[model samples]
Target: MAIKVKCFASMREYLDLSEREIGIDGIKTVADVWRSVAGGKPMPENTLCAVNQSQANEEFTVNSGDEVAFFPPVTGG
Candidate 1:
């Protein structure tokens, strides 16, 4: 099975990606997804994460065909 991953805002620039499809084997949690996609690069501090558009945490479980998204923290005046 496979999962879709999305990077948004600064996360896109940092990871040099907007979206990708990854194999889900052995990938359990959101943190595992990060480790797989980040490719040894540590996840950015306080990076926001979600699954299927709903807010989630690093500990969140992930399943095949899930859409996982990562975002850099947003700031406004």
Candidate 2:
């Protein structure tokens, strides 16, 4: 399956690109995909995850059509 990964803030620098498509087995979870694209580095602490625009988790199973966004936790002004 192909999943869309969007990196934000400092995370974008790690990837050096804002977005990319990753192909994975059907059994993979959100965390699995993140690790692969992250060069084996775990997602940053306090990172926010959303699948298809709804909040999700590391264990959240992804589908081919899902769009995932990873962003640093936002703080109020």
* Cα-based lDDT at residue 54, candidate 2: 82
In model 1, which range of ten residues has the least summed lDDT? Answer: 37-46
CA displacement after TM-score superposition, residue 72 of candidate 1 (Å): 1.2
All candidates: TM-score = 0.91, 0.81
Per-residue accuracy of model 1 over 34-63 as CA lDDT, tens digit each? 989897888877899999999999999999
**CA RMSD of each candidate after superposition:** 1.5, 2.0
Clashing pairs in 2: none
lDDT of candidate model 2 versus the reference? 0.78
- Assess each prediction's global lDDT (C-alpha) against the native: 0.93, 0.78
